[model samples]
Target: MKGNFNHFKILIVDDEEEYREVFKEILDEKGYITKAASSGEEALNILKTHSFHLVLTDLIMKGIDGIELLEKIKEEYSETEVIIITGYGTVENAVAAMKKGAFTYFIKSHDLEELTIEIEKIRKIFYLENDNEIFKNQQKNSKYMLNTNNKKFIKIINMAEKAANSNVNILILGDSGVGKEVFAKYIHSCSERKDRHFLAVNCHAFSDNLLESELFGHEKGAFTGAIEQRKGRFEAAHGGTLFLDEIGDISLSTQVKLLRTIETKKVERIGSNKTMDVDFRLISATNKDIQKSISNGEFREDLFYRISTIIIEIPPLRDRKEDLPNLIEFFLEKSKLELKKQIHTIEKKVMERLLSYDYPGNVRELKNIIERLVVLSENGIIKDIDLSKYRVDSERDTKSREEKIHNNKEVEEIQRIRSLKDIRSEAEAKYIKKALEISGNNVTEAARKLSISRRQLFNKINEYKLR
Candidate 1:
């Protein structure tokens, strides 16, 4: 081991001079560049002037204590790994120290053989990780198939690819269901970190404290129910990518921590003084208007700037109607394969209806609509009649009529002429169809959308011959 790792550096920190000397002598014999500190303060002072790959520190020290020293080293020298040594019957603190970012811990009373083996194992891991990163960086560039029919949409994809080639942070702006995560993944797959971890965290899903603990990791005893130390997204995504979805939803306090971590390239786990170094390219997405969020004091402006060094604003489906045909074809094929159906054609009128509607849910909604059509199709071919039952005619037509009514007396007269029951029936039918469309014809989902029971929706579908 010494022959192979002669260049590896190790630091030993112990208040007891004899123990420090003994450890240093063993490490020196093994050909490790060894340094010793009699106290935590001395260790820190040595660290300020020099650097080491690993640290061997006693759990109980006279001055700063091993835990505090571990934290300071981890925060300052994130690349440096620490291993805590404990006296007899202090195994729990050693374990706790491991949770606080120690690479591994050792029993002070034990022989140096076990400690040497652990160090050797860690050395192998470092080599493996470095080799893996190199392999990932050498893989062929990932292909991107973004819709290029719309110039603005094409521009965004092109811009994203350019940003991906660099190590810059990116922020994606778009409406919900607009495939922000997909875009993020595309960037990751195309980036240098293609084969590395690509972890995504939805900021809105967890509470403030939970989110903090989740992103920064936490000690075993960090909070209630934190039974064991856990690595967070940031740690796990080191040398890779981290996609923070719905970033605007994070609380102000968490934002501050996140900003500091991004600036320092370091993170402190909850209930742990240690700050670990993380090297990840962050890609954040949000449907919320971040500018508005900043003005509302809901989001941090400086943090936003740090995150949005390269911003890609995705166009809504409505703005990219030219891509509808291509999108429809893409989704149509996807749905067919997913549903295991052979849908070869769609009627011209059905295509027209699909292309005309303004999809509030964007591409996702369109994909669901195509899937619903495929699931509900009786024949292999999709036709006007099959789509007619699931038409959004009522809602679209109603809006048109309302607009006309506001503009013309003749439209108002026509509305007045219709019976109340007829108007109500029209609305009910339109809403039921909309619900069915949104739910992909799943009775349960349609019912939920309509705020009706499954049985009620079934009854309405039968009564209206909606099937």
Candidate 2:
């Protein structure tokens, strides 16, 4: 797993001790770390304590046949690629093993040279992936900067940097868009594994079944459309850091599996019986209140305790308004460069209005507004009118439509009276208005914010008969 190349740990599994010894002798000459197993049961047991990069398994083994061994290996130690070895008569079984996730197969009659070539291929792939991660880490370090002037925020960042000195599980609690991922990356950048891979996955994005496959990997035919064997995020993040965003969204079943993996440093791929050893520092983030979730029986308390060995809570943008200026300045220059604009300053009044406004979407919303200004402002200085145009009105409009209808009977009647189409139209109009206001009434910018075509937004504008 370490070193540039030719450092793969390999296991050879065969019922015939003689064949196993012969394979070991040939592989030893190639400088690979080789271990031999005489039966499928022995191979399974050996895999529990040992971590191997590849396994050369024989197909006609007695007791737990090769096909069964292949399934077990793919399920548990998915990080280890399996190659099925068979005689001419068992070629059919070898093909079946491939469908079940064997990496590839070799014929017993063929020269061992063929097996050596396959091993070399796997070695090259490992080197390429490792080097790519190092390169990406270097690139991120050069371009990303965590700029903050808030004293409390600074102290928290300092704590994170100190935590990075040791291997500890980190839990980041914050509202969305508060730069949780920024802190996660900062920790990784400061850690000893800085040069290794830093991978992140949003746990809320996939369904439970899909998430299982994403975290634990799957064999070629593990499920429909699996098509080919794939490595999960955990496998990819081995010897590095893995940031699981929205960890609270994972189901209880997944929480159990995750807790086990953290405890044992091993994982079983979906539909695989083999277990793979993984070493990674976990960093998880969730916008949801985890304590509240545990009380509601939606999250596991034990898992929470396991992951929160170190907790860092980031204050919302509204609470940490003191950091606004530096953040604004950073985004201002970024927008200018991105848009190739000459805008360099905001009017004093405009700056005051911005500082007073509540950013419900936090830093992400602020950056979006800054970019809009850079692209639309005719002058180098953003004026008061520009600030007014981009301001979100939800803070100003305290009494929403639903709030005005206080009577339960009236609310029920209104809901019953309005068709789904009519209600959807009304909501769409409100959002369009809000998007238009936030984009300074620029149709193109509003369309972009709504993630719709400019022409479609224009059509809706006409349909609603909006000025």
Candidate 3:
């Protein structure tokens, strides 16, 4: 068990001096730079003076219990991992501590082997996470690909690339989580204007006037909050590709201005009559059916024709079940590297169960599921994943999703023939996709409707393979 991580820094917190000293002596014997604190306040003060890679704290104390300490630690130092120590007397509190952001928990008076092993595991994970971030950043900074190791993705990529090389205006159609933005980036990266800026805008993020000002330049004092002159996406991306994500979500008035920009390749800034030429390529995405919006009179017809010269529809993940194996492998490797866990493999049972899932949210949802497992699973292997605990197999989850879309009320009630896991997973996926559609992929808005955190939404996005 002796390894390079022997030099890792550690902190132990307990109100009992003898208990703290005992653990400190044991840890020090293992060559760790160990520190001890008698209370949460004392630990916080010590933390302010110094930093440690890991903190091991008792779950209960007189002042500022372990849960509060965990909260404070997570808030101040997001990178630092903390584990809660509990006796049989307060076992539930220890588990609650984990939810509050404690990395792991331990039962006091038991063997210290698990704790020691967990520390080494976490230290390795911390380093791996650092490396993974660098890798992801590099991928972002450099040219991005479709991340598709499959035929359909390859064909889609080819189609988008061809459209980009040509002079056709592109309208990318897909349900949310179908990697529309990734496809958009691919088109830009492969285009002749690859050297120019690629500007992407979510049409629903701002109010009509604000969205207008964002697309076209705005003069100072144009509106109450217009404090300074600003260049819009059209101007900034003059010689590049302008990506309009969720184009169908924009208001009717804003759509008129957008039509003008694409039709004339010119824009007039707000509060100014000066026309500016924008020699740029146009690419737009929409989860909604523009034809429906047009029929409903919520979208502009001429603009739809103008943007749909080349239309590419992305397939949802459920339609491409064959790619599940590769996607899982990709996410597994990604999570292992990111989480700094030697999770070299997943259990056959878990994999088989995962493959059975419909994954309504798509690739994004799958990543979140895998990330959650990587974080919460004991040891380096994810064995018996409690899908029910994760809301993956809940009647409430599936019911809410179906109610939102199919009936706008409730669908015909039927006896649930499938396992709770399958039902819940399908339900959760639907909710995410619909939320993205409703909120136009604005994380905050989606979180509001789903009643989850932006972080949780982000996590689920990756877990369920939503995108």
Candidate 4:
């Protein structure tokens, strides 16, 4: 009565013909689309063919009772709420049903007023959920509204939308700074869990012990400095979405615990014996080649399968260069507002330079570049500035192309030609050196930029004698 009840569909599951007809007739008269199923099996069959907002089922049935039906519905169609219908004698069983995820239970009576009240409550919940999702979408518009024209990226967006409607664990893979976490948040914002907390954790940013405590929480005195009991990301994200960034970087031990928690939907805090049940959609992301990590025994295969029910791979900025102009404009406006600069025009030469350079740090690098330009602009005009000051490798890229052309000419004029393998090795060495330079000679960071394991990069360095 409080909300639009016409959109709500109710399934009445009862073996008794009279009760089924009575429930259906009552709900239909109340303006709810109602369907009747003689048993739990019939209800499940109906569910496969159609969607329902709620299911009203009798606790005592011939086969596949109310509790079993509730479990199946929660396991599959989790968005559908269930209310158990019990006789006076089976009230205890109905209570058990509530513990197992039933919305509520009602005793059979001629009055049937309690049934109508329960349905109204569910409708109110639906109304509130719709309002919350709309509000959240509006709040997140500026932060997550990534406009792209690339066809492949558009398809990825469509796939993400479909994935959002279901309760599936997602794994987003891309290079560093390619907006994997942003995509994860987009999925969360488009999901039924949008109204709830969207908690994110960077797995690569913490030590093994700290990461474990951060994910599973820690009681007071759990460790040397853990003076107070604190809830972890998983607990804090209950009934919402938990985003694990750089998921491939987590240790195998932590992976094992994560796998168990995901499987059981429960977690035990450090120094606490009690296990708390948590329900949260998992959306993990990593720039690393996860298959290589699995082959190298750095990540668990079981955990990978569990978290990667739906995998979304994002293209690097270089591949989707068509979106560069729009992205540049967006970042330019954003930077202007943030820096409080009245910069109005970007020089043609400056725009050309911005478009030509391959963004090794993807969108994030472009944003930084725009912000830097805004900061350096004089007299409200953006003129050609020294890109090298920002560590942009455009000059180095041009020199590399020149050197490559010179090398090709030399190879053609020489009597004895170099083998293809040798040529490839030389090119690879130069690229690795460039990556190292871009990462300030930090081997770990260079490896990440190269999309290879640190050990693999170290082996390549030794093979090329570059270190």
Candidate 5:
């Protein structure tokens, strides 16, 4: 099933039937899903219909030449690797193809063995950087930055600050990379404990025993290699804030001890019987559903209720993309200053392309992408054409794009606005229908998510006829 995710495609365009067939056969046997075309025209048509990770074309063609195909493919599909095959392999033709985004040029008479290694390098780029930007920038808003203009973000941040003004435990839940730590830091910085030490630890990074010792400290010769008295994160964070990241990944055995410490506000260090009273604001974060983990026996139900007295679910990047331009400006400035480059001003078209892509990795991914773009961006402008080498490979598949548009229309058309009063009802019905379908129709869960009273939700259910 994991192999299903790595399935890649390659397109071959060659006038020689024998060479085309042999290359396709070799690539197919080597696990690449391959396609073959006899001419550049056929190659273009196939490319529009399906996505390819790489395309290999012969320099000499019967009709519309390979150089033109390279230009079109580079313009249309920047992420797709292109290799040119030529019998002559002249300096003039080689330079032209390379300038037009030809990854490598090979002599047709030579062995095709070197081509595989070249393809592997392109594959690494896909794995490390693939869809990372698309996920972050799919919406027009930058997901990574706090939106000053967004009333929702401002409201949430203000509410979080108010919550931090107290001494209560808070739990933050959101998709990974949603800036849980960002908000945590905001709470800490704005709280009465701003001047104190604000320590944070990733609960998932260590095993049960190691995490316990890290949180609770150890005396001299406690367990293995405990030669001196050690101060735990709790002790160090005393009278301040202790931020636990990815708290959902903590083991069940570790959860019990954590619950005990959180409940008692006391810790007995290892190899010592001294019960240390710890005072700190606990701020835990998880990308997982604590209730689901509790149901699955992976987490304690009592701990779930105890830590989530004040829960904040961070929104995904797509929902608040209106802040992207500001974030892009900030990131570009940072990249320019750090990289010592005179990069300034990105083209509007490049911003449009960035907004059009989905960014699954959230703000962190966007920062990395902007850093790369700044270093690679030519001249003073980061134009769409300059980013031609970094578009999502699937975006080149015109057929799939059309299919997505059609599917969205089909879903939207179902929202029948029977009356002015029913417009809100209709849209709500549509989204509730979708989320329930995606979540397999657990009404209690859906009601909790819709943030509506179960009784009010049932009324809407009856109004919309959602069984």
Candidate 6:
């Protein structure tokens, strides 16, 4: 019942002056900015001059009827939502109005409660659709990526900021889950097109035919499932930004069409002869090695050059170990908020393990791990976590690297003609010491790292006097 409706303006249109005045008065009392138009023609005139979030128009009116006005509003001001007002016996007409793009219709009645509720829902939708609100939320959640201690990443951010001022295409190269989309949005937020839409498409998520139709749109009857004409992302994102994620995964044929669209600034809907001009900033991202892909003829070299006018490469999380503490804190607070838990402390061993583990999935994996820990936490403390569940591949990779190190040492020791028993004991002791160091001398973590039980690790410690 209590809400802020000052930002949303509503126009009440009805042939009857009393109905328009009464509805406007009630809406005004509810804190909504309201305007009244006696006829649908007057409503259209007012709309041409000012913006309104929702149009409340009577179905039966002189000159232009509600349906006619609704069609005009949709064709001209597609963003505005409409609600048709009808008499008791005109429910069928209201239903028809809905199919023609009315948000919802209501019967004219003394009680205004249902109308108010519908208005509140539309206001909430508008709030979510607001680009500024979305940008603020993104800034709150992705601030960790923007503010980092890594010098190379700081340079990348700086380059992105500078690139945002220009109308150049950008290609973000990084591993999966490295916040490529976040960086793309950051660039869009800083750019001149910040107030407009920031549309993102995952090129890897769709088939070649589907992706083509998705980007270029389709006319009615263009394909078997195409029932109505639809505008594509390129057209919808006019005067804004379009982020193509996993661009390297798009088929070569799609790449050719994409390249032409970029160069011509025009898009032709599928099965349509007419082309519409579109202007939007382009930001692309991919985890694949695009240069290798191009060499292998998997990606177009020319499209690569066009999209990579300003390339920004983000390093993997493992390479930026220094920023882990801040990243952990961010995700911890975010998870706590999402999970609605009051976690106040992280045990030293848990923190150590979290800090030492190499996240192959990057920031996204770290976020998921934190959420899992929060879910499993007890007594408002995060003490124990089975990171092995999330680190299966990372553990395997670590073991492979360790084996290479052990093998290199074994070859050197064999060259020196050392006894095999002595060599084995020395290598085991050295490996144990290394794991203990990596685990920050935590016995449980060291044991886990060595793939042994705590008692076994303690026995080894005592046998070698390694404590």
TM-score of 6: 0.62
TM-score of 1: 0.57
TM-score of each candidate structure, all chains considered together:
0.57, 0.59, 0.57, 0.58, 0.54, 0.62
* Model 2 per-residue lDDT tens digits across residues 138-176: 446323435666788778888898998999999999987
Candidate 2: where is the Cα deviation over 4 Å?
Answer: 1-145, 379-381, 392-467
lDDT values, one for every candidate: 0.82, 0.83, 0.79, 0.85, 0.77, 0.85
Q: Which of the two candidates, 2 or 5, achieves a greater TM-score against the reference?
A: 2
In model 6, what is the error at residue 193, expressed in angstroms? Answer: 0.6
Residue range 237-272, candidate 6, lDDT tens digits = 899999999999999899999999999999999999
Task: State the lDDT of candidate 1 residue by residue for 157-178, as single tens digits.
Answer: 8889899999999999999877
- Model 1 segments more than 4 A misplaced: 1-145, 383-467
lDDT of 5 at 237: 87
Question: Which pairs, if any, clash in model 1?
Answer: none
Per-candidate count of clashing residue pairs (backbone under 3 Å): 0, 8, 25, 0, 12, 0
Root-mean-square deviation of every model: 18.3, 16.8, 17.7, 20.2, 19.3, 16.6
| True-structure Cα RMSD, model 2 | 16.8
Summarize candidate 3's per-residue lDDT along 196-278 as a digit string, tens digits.
66778877566687788988979988878777788888998899889998999998888888888888999888988899888
Residue 355 Cα positional deviation in candidate 1, in Å, after optimal superposition: 1.1
Model 6: pairs clashing at backbone N, Cα or C within 3 Å: none
Q: Give the total clashing residue pairs for model 2.
A: 8
Q: Pick the candidate with the highest TM-score.
A: 6
Tens digit per residue, CA lDDT, model 5, 141-186? 3323555666777788778978988988999988876678777877
User: Residue by residue across 1-467, what tens digits does model 4's lDDT show?
Assistant: 22337578999999999999989887888889989999999999999999999999999999899999999999999999999999899999999999989999999963698889988999889867876785565446424446788999989989998999999999999988888877888888789997787887878767799999999999998889887788988999899999999999898889989999999999999999999999999999998899999999998999999999999999999988888898888878877886789986777778777887889789867876777678678888887754556545555667886688677866464456779788778978987887687668999877855656786788789889997
